[model samples]
Target: MRRRPSKEQFEQQIEQTAKALHDEMIAGKWAAGSFLPPEKSLEARFGLSNYSIRLGLEQLVQEGWIEKIAGVGNRVVATRPQVKLTIACENVTLRNLKTSGAGRTISAFYPWIQVEFLSMISPIPGTDLSERTLAGDLVLLDNVQFQQLSENRLTHLLEPLSEDDEWYPQFTKHFSVEGRRLLQPIVLSPLVLCYNKAHFRESGLAEPNGSWTWNDLIRHAELLYDGRGRYGFAFHIQSLYRWPLFLIQSRERFEESGEEFLRSRSSRLLDGLKLCKDILHNRKAVPLYLSENNDDINRMFMEGKLSMTLNTYMGLNSWNEAEIEYDISPVPYMDSPRTLLITLGAGINGSSEHKEEARLLVDFLGRCGRERESAYADRIRHYCKCCAQRLP
Candidate 1:
């Protein structure tokens, strides 16, 4: 019979549970006003009593991390503060000035210089102190991202995509974007494919190279299968979105021309679905179902039972914390090496009272110098670049 966890073990489990919930919030898995799993279900999943689960939920609620409705259950309340902005402006150049010319008396000779100064500083307002601009209501205008400057209103919301027929016409009309500044663009990191080095060696298979393709993956999975209890590969169904990385690797475009320009070709989508079904059914190389209810894959990986799994870089961090021996490779490709990327950004609400401050925060993100930009980049770098192919 299996042994029950000791008191110390139980405490550790509670900590792990709390950390998982926190990670989910960071990933935007739980949106605003969405309730998490019920306490009873959580208790079963964590192998704890109702009281222990309640304690964890209560801690989240007290920290303003989440809010508990009278009958609706606990919902994520706290989101990351948008004091910093992340922007993409690869072509624009900015100028730096040590002192302003407001106090100095200037003659007509300064005409050209005055025009240059005004041209540089006119588009961006925060740099000029003499101008009668609203300082608190800072407004940052990037290509597609924005943020608020106020401390109380720090939620990062994404701006609706533009509907310009030139690019995405439907989106342009949806957002009513006839005349609006595009926020700065933010790049997302690619999902990573991870495996256990020790397991590979023990099974007499070579460590997968970064250039391995989908067929290579299938062959490796076949070698690793024991056909007794554990499977060769297992991933959560919800994470199937990453399958597009394989299609990209194969050099297939996700979109094609059609009356409904946004609609995907059924044949291409079927091919992708078949690939997953083959891995899970035809070859029986992976399990068809693996509940993330309690992070079952994570448990299996930590226990040294799983040979391979595909997940985000953040998932790798969890494996490291659990002391699991593993290595990460690029997601397998079909023709070219590519991985799906998921980017995030912040925006000010249209109805926000602190519009100017929000704009300042957004401006700071895009136009700010290297120091601030690097800080933001470093925060999420670990999860952003595992085996990712550069966009050409």
Candidate 2:
């Protein structure tokens, strides 16, 4: 008997199938106005079920890569001159077609950009998309990717989008190179302390505050521990986003690998490393981080398994429906309140022939983050496309 695949496995198969078909289309395997391979042929090619093949094709149709002809088949949309804009996206979560809000946040921006233009949005696989590659006319990028593309000269230096008086000047400067701001910021969040207030009330502990120090966090965390199945403090300490918190706090760059990093002479850097080390080794404070992704850590926070953890606004996207009581505060400071910020923005591909169209998309997406701002999520509601998922 054939064994059934897990949900994750099935989703991976769908993404692989979608990416396989997308890569082929972009590489010009199938000519314009031609119908894609039949479902049976695609099934054999990608080793997916008929349903999975249909779902994969459905994603392409939604992205405008193909159109379904009644009673015929899905035909590849004609390329270029007819369509003024082409969008390239990163599969930050490998989910562009899901019905849920979290899955569709990034995907929903395409329709607004597609207004009055024949456009296709391809969520290029992160592994397949390189630092210097331009998959489409306009690319949706995060802070890091935009900077990388800017450094490599692959992104169009959008002259008109340089300044918005309301935007954080420093962040706007981060996207600029040699007097030209390249990408427009859409959504951003700084690392903050997220705690289960119920846990604090139950534990008779005062809530966290900006004035708290690392030593205070460690002490409160110890008190917060109930010797129950839950851990008082924990995070996916190995995450790139999490691990760097220590170095950034120390105001030092521990940029090295192997023996060189291990033998670094920077005392301030070592001080930060020691903090992370203590927390990881202090089993009474944090649990063993054996699980994958921030979701594993986030699940603990959501289910009341963790009392407190460091998080960004994006991590709380699902908290809208959680029954648990929680609150946010500035992360405990070591030396100062300086914290890491993560931003998602859009950039125009330098090679894009349709510069004006690309600008419109960025303008619409980055237009305003503060209009309906909430105490919890600053500008998240508008750009996250969580107009469907309301935040408290």
Question: What digit string (tens of lDDT, one per residue) describes model 2 on residues 1-392?
Answer: 99999999998899888877775665457766899988889888887889999998898888778888888898988742233465555544212211144224433443323322112233322222453345566666656556555556654443435466666575577677777777777666567788999989988889998788888888888888878778888888756556667777777655567776776665687888898898778778888767676778888888888999987765566566789889987777678765666666667766677665566566656764433233436434322221211110
> Model 2: residues >4 Å from true position, as ranges?
1-87, 91-134, 147-166, 254-264, 370-392
Q: How close to the true structure is residue 93 of candidate 2, measured as C-alpha lDDT?
A: 24
> What are the models' TM-scores?
0.46, 0.61
In candidate 1, stretches whose alpha carbon ends up further than 4 angstroms from where it belongs are: 1-187, 250-269, 282-284, 290-294, 314-317, 363-392
Give the top-scoring candidate (TM-score). Answer: 2
lDDT of each: 0.49, 0.66
The alpha-carbon lDDT assigned to residue 204 of candidate 2 equals: 85
Per residue, candidate 1 scores C-alpha lDDT tens digits across 1-392 of 97888989877777777767765664457765677988888888877788778777877776566888888788877453332212211111111111123102121211111111112233332123222222122222221122221122322332333322322222222122335433332223347778888879888888876677767887888778777755677776544334555454444454546743345445454566567667767345675565653267767767766688777642343444567678877677655555655332223444445443344344333333233335545533443333233211
